[model samples]
Target: MKILISWLGKTDIDHMQVDKLAAIATLATKHTAPFDTVLILANAWEEHWHDYEKWLNKRLAVISRPAEVEVRQQSLSSPIDYVAIAAVMLRNLQALCQGDNQVYINLTSGTPAMTAMSVLIGQGMYQCHFLQAAPDNSVVEVRIPLDFAATYKKAVSTSVRNKVIAGPSLSSEFSRIAAESDAMKAALNKAAKLAATDLPALILGETGTGKELLATAIHAAGNRSAKPLKTINCGALPENLVDSILFGHVKGAFTGANNDHAGLFEQADGGTLFLDEVGELTPAVQVKLLRALQQGEITRVGDSKTRQVDVRVIAATHRQLATMVAEGTFREDLFYRIAVGVIELPPLRHRTADIPDLVKQIMAEINAVFSKQPDYKSKKISSSAIKFIATQPWPGNIRALWNALNRAVLWADNTELTVTDIQNATVDAVKTDESSPVVPEFVAGFDIQQYIDGIKENIVKAALDKTGGNKSKAAKLLGLANHQTLANWMKNLGIAEQ
Candidate 1:
């Protein structure tokens, strides 16, 4: 798409003061071809900047040069400060250049410093088209056939490019996610590399292994950090409501539809959308998701109009998607598109080396929450407690570990949580997993298959009862991929929900 990016200058709004057409209008009319989108960076402090946006759109329509106008507010210390102006312009330019966009930087708008920086950045980094308004309000190409600006351009471009991905900011973004084990370190290393680009990423790991947390860190460390980071759990969404929630619907499209609704994709434009438990998406939703990722566009459930969105999708799931694809349950094409950059996080059992640090971190968090309460003493775990924690096979991963520690802290009378406290808190979970199965007698007409089915039925019913008939929670308790798997099991076992 041909995109015209320009700073909204004083002349662009004060039409009564200008003798002829505004600089932006002239550039749009006299250009070789009409632009698909006009991206304007306006001053945030200007009270009537939105008025200028409306005026510019109307002016363009009057002249038959209709382009989608997107105004982004930029806060600058000074309009003439070349450094400040270049920083704002470079950041926006970098995001624009990420796509296959034919960028045109207009030098006739804003101050003289703005124009100069635009030319330097455009020539040095992008080599995009540069245009300016002539004396008679005609648009002319501005070309500089000089090599002196090469050094300055190279230095500035490199800084802008490396500042977020390769610099200290990258580390800071992931600082909240603590890891000490080699397996976890490797996973985080892969995540850091993926955060440097705008690729659709897939995070594969067991549940409670912090997939969403890692996804958040990746978004914070990427180009879309300045925009929204919307998140949703696909497994938690009701089957009937999935379409409307992800792609929205027009008013009167459905029985409950009352007004126009913006879905997660539209809400996360120029940002990131983290889809947790993505393997739970139905086949129909998979097709629509693939189209959105492939084309950067989506249509409402019952609307024919298509809307464009620039969303970096980060999907996470504990389910083995490759296995699902082979089983003809998940779409292979969608898998490949979203798995361009995959990070497989090791479960807490495999990362026992990091348990001590995790214990410290989680305990600190617990203390912070109860700090303000009167007579609430800060608690610390004994070394023996940490050792006991590391010895267990945490099937629920980090989340399970945190729950045990939080419980231990709350129940213990002293400030120091001992191994006894930890054991008491985690006893139910460990005992449940370690329970032995009943042995069957080897008698005539014993039908082993029927006996096994009976056992399966009992287990399913027990899990359902334990979770109060919530299929999703019961599935998690039974170690199933999602509620759908639980339902399939119940059907096969000839069991019914209470």
Candidate 2:
């Protein structure tokens, strides 16, 4: 059975009321193949669906088509509620996409969120053909490239399944992570699947992007849940004690080695070992780390014999290891080993839709801490305050957002925090921290050009997202000379235009 599925939009309703050709109408009349059933999803008032179905039936009859019309209400908390939209898409697809049923998804007749969800779910999870109707009354099949389609299918299918099983995404270890954007959800979906195996996983993201939190979650959800999950910050490890700390040492092995100490690899035996900022490891340490990962064994600093240890390594770094490999800093062999199950976490700015939920969670934690104070006074943030906070570029990611919220709550002298409070908080957050303005630490092997290009990529992408991919508007936002300048920069930076 061939079926066409679409969401009822305001423009679609208006066109039907005026007896003009709507997006769905155009699809039905112009598409080469005829649909056996036309399923219309409506999420508006009750009366809207009734009138829409009536007009839809009349139009189909006028066209002399015998397609059956079915209208169903797809409830949502709001037009842009990504969680609700994903769940609805999953349920509908699970029901309609049975064996031998050909499904056609109309990406032309709905809100941007609706259309996006349809594309992601339809193209990624199911064998559904997609159609988009332009204002010219022409309908075209939306084709996704093969490689991306396969990845999209895997990531999106996992996301939908996790959301469905968790029932509102609140119970499971993966569900507890608050997220509303597709980027974060996709990352989480990949993480959950990686958790099921003992493969070495690499998580890449900016600092304060919750790499450690994700590593811990993967450990807790994996088969090694009963064993110890040891964590070590390679960046903070003492240069002299790096070998002793990682592979352990026997008594009298070194000047300070008075006792036989077990290192992290030994301690994390039969479980997972999280290597935070793995890119910071020195060249010598990388060889030993790679040995342990490949041989499943390690030798003490002064010991000639190697002892077996079962450990799954989950390494994370803000640095681009591939760049390091090209520069001959990080080992290429180790890179491929840990990158078997790589997951790149999107920075907080890219997943701004999650800010509100993160705010709520942070506020609850703050309120709980404040309740213990003698002169505690809990505060609520106004919607405008949230909107204002969401507009800024949080270069520091979640950690930055948390600090800003904390500052706002502490400095604001009111029960309810307003936009002014948020604005003041942001200004104060950027003020000079000591003698001069604060500066980020430049570590060894830091690529200044790569860093600059990263900032440009982020800013350009944010502008494009804000302007709905309009080159002219995005150029204006970035203070560029013109859209042509923006285009040149985008091409140079490899920032693809959607």
Candidate 3:
């Protein structure tokens, strides 16, 4: 598919924006190859124009093509009118989108002028797709087909319904990694079908939800199964070092570059590269990544010569890329490229019915680990322990279950592990301060306001603690009316802002 990126000149190359671009580029290279193009359109404001060349050059160097940069100079004396800019961009995009299979990346929120242009152009463009950068540096892509826009109002209404009903799915092979519930299994089956194809797959879920595991499973089952599986944790990398690690650097390319080294792309040649936490990439890296994926080649950091490599890509993240795209922290084009096929893994609590199977499998594995010692033979779990595990909400999912089991194993002196042993281990491992000043006990004749305030405070605090202080998440844990109500309660209690 052919891709186009149009943005206002005044956009800043912030860390978050760069990271979003990197994620997009990675996705594009992995899913859609040999047929993609990127177009960058910027207004001619002094600030926007000043760094244009540098930014353009850097971006061009990373992507796999000779970038087509278009600079439109608006009259400085005239007040910036976004509607006019949108018209201009739409006209330009219309010409580029003549092909039947075409996509547009709208990064029009870099400045007030660009934001206005994006909204107008976005609303008017019948056949184009729009992508926005979110505050957390993720991308949100909106695909507006020309035919759909013919009856725009109805199409929008139906789109929401379709998405809600679709939910998300994962590949079937994920079932082997963990015993997932029916809902989760269905999601996995959906993902498996998507993985069989060459589409870029975005694996979304919460932390420890096995996103990487799913990616690895996809690579293992794909046509490129014989190839190596390379993984990179985007969030863990240093911003400055990302380029060299990904695209390689020539000897003396930087201060620490004593010798030339092939980057991860080269190493993953004829295989798959799995990028974890892709939302953490920087814009500078994004530009280069966009080029590489588009062109199917890479140049060492300091080298002018480009080297080609063949590799498939799989990416995973826990954050909402759509939200990041809206806030101008991500690249619109990159988002569209990687989102060809999206799969979301369900959290642990949502699949409570699968707990029994998971517990049995975990116990078996633990037993296998202790197989060597006759005195430390495999132990059997009591019915009460199994029931207790089923009842407690596992916020951390399989990871949390594994940890809890480990703790229980440590505390179990008998051949059979019981509910008391598990409970004791959980209480001992969980952090709680006994030295802190205690709130007065609720008395039968307590003041009504005081009693209500105390209960609210306790409930809110417990939920926050359970979710590690993520307010939106804490609200879900508490089963609050919504995030707003949780926020109001937090404000009333004077708890620290999330």
Candidate 4:
């Protein structure tokens, strides 16, 4: 049940029948090595493989024992046909080759390109042994060194092929949003394939899984790319404002209403509307959304008129809508309406193989952002730094990875980001969490400067409230130089005077 996949070299070459030498070496091996069969890959030059098979069988018969034999004719199209060959080998070997049977590839024959491909498939994916029909009448076994980077070469190769075939710009966007993991590739390709249809798509992924990004890509890849794509975060809005924000509100529609506002649907009239975290919508909002999906119309708050709109919808959620449906929290009809197409994104931990690419990607963008500031300095990451990062269990997925790298970019000074730099960045996050008034989960991903500015704005507002809205008293309570300084701080933070 042993097998050796060897190429049938051209008869015009000096190595007219490479399989014969390979067979002799296999028979002469130290242990009774289980090299009992051969699978030959041949091209058009092998017009009389039957005669060669007869010759090969005669040569093999002279050995201690006979082996099963077969030859598959193939059409050569490119110099690097190994990609397709490796793909086929991956599919078939897993299905057919297993158990006590041993496998090897005879790389001593064929074109240099073919031999190199054999080595790649053997070492990269199959972990198969290498057999060389040594001219000295001995067998040469090639063993590849083992390492974390070396072990993941097969996965890396697949990712490279996917990126190459996916085109430069399209693959760039997809990888930026959801690196080249097998799961993400499947989900992403499915989204793109189905993007043209008008059916509603439901994207499922955990927090920081790039649901919003994927939704946007699907919209652009579809027929609606030419039109506006309005997006809203359902989770951030309160139950009362969901209706008004999504379906429009007239002037004086409520107590504080001052002017008419077009909702997402109206704004996206002939395009697509993306609802991020759709599972977080209140039951009332869900009912209204269901009505809109089923009836192709939306009614403004406090207005009885229902206006017809032709807006395609793409809903995404990190939560389990099925569980909510079972719990009677989400409408079953709404769930079905939005579930016309479903794509589940894998978490970052599952796609650790894609981390290196993500590191390069996020770092490039981080550098671009850094170049915008006079005080901020751009940073590059070391290969070891990337390796150290890939070893971590990124529970927060891509967002957490980016957040850590963002800090590292700011922390590193005139040096490439190292393992210690990344560790320091994460350590700082831990310290920030311990001293925060709120829970770490709530503040984990907030930008440091933005968070500080928000705290300053809140404190200023609180001081003014306690001082009867008097700028002078607020400044006095805060020990500022004058009311003008307090006013300037407020203006800088974009907080209007009360």
Candidate 5:
């Protein structure tokens, strides 16, 4: 069940007067001598790619005797596309590997970035054997040593027990949060699984979408719960401050270093470190972070001695990290390292079915606070009030909803919170002070098409509900060409016109 994977480089002679394919062809002989198939990792954009692929398959057919040979192409914009290279290699292994197969990867070809990525992924994840063909036509297995996990070695065959944190990821905190939509539910479930593993997890979402809450729940569900869970806001800290905050500094390390400070890395040693707004980290800090992950240790700001840490990193950000990497603002290597696991939280407006339940929860908590006050009563929302709250486009997600509830509950005259009170509070919430009157800079995951369609549905539904299913008035309120257009929209969107 063993297979061979190698990249097809130019057939031109190297500095050592050796052909690259000579090594690949030589390595394939040993790997395919007892194999089921072969996977040739090639750059399809390169000239004469088909010729190389055909030659390798023909050579393997005679030298090794494999049943099939397939060429996997790389279409990345450049040879330095580490992310794409790793993805392709891992995917090839996933598809070609078997339970008892010995996977051999020829590292002599491909870009240096590709070689590094393939080695990292092969060693860290796939446990594949690395092979290199010598100039003398001799092939030898290439072994990689890992820093984080001492026992991790290329092509190791011994079975070892996994030591992940033992618990269900869905703790009471996450369970209590109402995410009724299927997308949110799926995200939470996957986040929980990722929380248990040592792989770094990235949570992407709009502001107030509860990214930190999810990270906290993940920490609570992991093996390191007993240890301190340290948090740092990457966006808030300046470059120098970030160094001291994350990697600590010895006493008098800087002008203001009055005392020895333990950075977030040392504080969170043997625990989880939540890096909030990770996308805002400067290039220097990103480089340091990457080094720490690669070396499985960190040095203080003033000390050259590296301290070993067994910390799991969980990062959250609202910025588009892929775009940042493309723009050269974020390190591509660091992005791939931290992006091992990703979770995207859906905004509250997309899952409005949970609004009614959230209303109840918020009101109950609000009443508990009011019970201690004199001349004040707890508040309750009517069905109509909940419906209105669900219709409004919540750009700020759950945080916005909570704030609006505070205003509505306080403005209510009696125990029963009515529609007018909610409307009044909504109006008050929309007003801005003189100092900051302009709109927010962040879009917060707002989809223009989705928002427009949702607004249309709300208007159409509200108008029809108000006019008692009067098509003419509903169309007039919606400014549609005619009632026919309204009917068409409802039909296309699968909305019942009744």
Candidate 6:
């Protein structure tokens, strides 16, 4: 397959940006060899055309298949004047669309004109693939046929709905750490299915939801299981270091480069590279990444030689990638590529049924850890303690559960753990109000009717807040006997209609 990379250029090329693009081209040649060619289209003004071409040529020479690399520069009177330049490039790409060869387009670092041209070309070239650069400076390739605009639109709409309704999928690598819940099981099953395929998978979920676990599991189950499982936390790295870490660097490539280093791509050859928190990658990194994914090759920093590597990638994140893409924080083409098979993990609160089993397992594990002797001691968990644990909201999910159990085990002076132990340990950690205010000892002659009314009002208010002031929904949530009762209470309490 032949892939074309077209990007618009300003009067001057950023040295780092040029190097990154060169790295991508090298990587692509390695992956899609013998049939692929990269076409770089840049606009130049009269003053900088010669300098730009010289710089571009020097960078392009570092690519493995320099012969297959084509650089086209159109001249304009001024750098800012791109109207005619864009028109010509678009017309040329449109002409190239009629060819029988399969073409994939990279728009990750393309100028606005190039992006527009890509969209237009995409509409006409049904066989073309769209690749975008991700925030981590990786390439994300997407296959959207020209005739499937309607389908693409529908899919995007559904994806948005899923995000709103279900949130992000949990990381497959972190699945083992999550509590046993139906939602967790469903997420695991979905992850397993996606693991069987080679397509790029996007995992979404809130922080501490074990997204990395899911990614690891998927990688372990895949064909690359025997190879190294490399992981990069996109959010943890600085912008300048991301490319060097991911694509490697030659000796003396930068100030910190004491020796030549192979990047994650080379390390993960015939294995898996797990990108965690991928939403945090910068646009420059995204462009390079898009090129690498499209071509499947990479070059070391400060070197022109190219090498091919086979690596399956699984990316995880808690942020909304789609929203980021829409807001220009993420590349749209990259989003489409990584989201081929998306899986969402539900929060702990939604699956309360599995809490008992989870608690039992956690308690056993905690007991084993706490015992100094190698011998395992059987400890009984009080029924009241179990009941309390089940009722309390676990915002931190399974991690919180494990920590709570560890604390309980530490405080358990005997073989039995009571409700007080679990409550004290967990309630404080979860920031729950544990003190019951003593209740004034509940005098026997207290006004019972007034007390009931006050209790009812509090419950109504809590329910209303939980349901966002939707009276009918609040009535159902609060388990009020009927709508009329809720209405009566609302009127009596002087609660105006919301």
Q: Which stretches of candidate 2 lie over 4 Å from their true place?
A: 1-171, 428-498
**How does each model score on lDDT?**
0.83, 0.84, 0.68, 0.73, 0.75, 0.68
TM-score of candidate 4 relative to the true fold: 0.51
Clashing pairs for predicted structure model 5, backbone only = none
Writing each residue's lDDT as its tens digit, candidate 1 over 394-426 gives: 778999998988889889999999877886787
Global Cα lDDT for candidate 2: 0.84
Q: TM-score of each candidate? A: 0.61, 0.54, 0.53, 0.51, 0.55, 0.52
Between candidates 1 and 4, name the one with more favorable TM-score.
Answer: 1
When summed lDDT is taken over every stretch of 10 residues in candidate 6, the lowest stretch is 429-438
For 229-286, candidate 5 gives per-residue lDDT tens digits of: 9888888888758778788999878898888888888899779999999999989889
Residue-wise lDDT of candidate 2 within 87-191, one digit each (tens)?
778779889999899999999887899888888888778988999898898999888665557676899899789867977422277776877999999999889
Arranged by lDDT with the best first, the candidates are 2, 1, 5, 4, 6, 3
Evaluated against the true structure, the overall lDDT of model 3 is 0.68
| lDDT digits (tens) for residues 1-498 of candidate 6 | 465656644412453344444323433443344335666666543454455445555554556344355566654444343444445555566666665766666665545655665666565445466766555545666655446567678898997798679955545444454446767677777876677678788898877566776788888777677889999998887778877888899999889899999999989987888889999888888888877777778888899876666778888888999899889999998888778888886655676766777778777777666676554465778877777677656767667877888887777776788876775576445332223232635777988677656666666765564444678877876677777789899888767766
Q: Residues 1-498, candidate 4: write the lDDT tens digits.
A: 677777766531223345434433343232247457767767655566776666556666676556666677754565466644554455445643578766777776566777776666666656577777655656777675654355588788897799689884453445446456788778877786668588899999988877888888888877788999998888887787878888898888998888888888889987999998998888777877888888877888888766667788899898999999999998999999989899998988788778888888898898898789986666789998887787665657788889999888887785599877886675423222223466424565768777787667767866665454789978987789999999999899887778
Where model 6 places Cα greater than 4 Å from the true spot, the runs are 1-181, 372-380, 431-498
lDDT computed for candidate 4: 0.73
**Deviating ranges (above 4 Å) for candidate 4:** 1-178, 375-377, 428-498
Which number leads on TM-score? 1
6 in model 2: Cα distance from truth in Å?
A: 69
For candidate 3, the per-residue lDDT at 228 reads 87
Whole-model lDDT for model 6 versus the true structure?
A: 0.68
Residues forming the 10-long window of minimal summed lDDT in candidate 2? 428-437
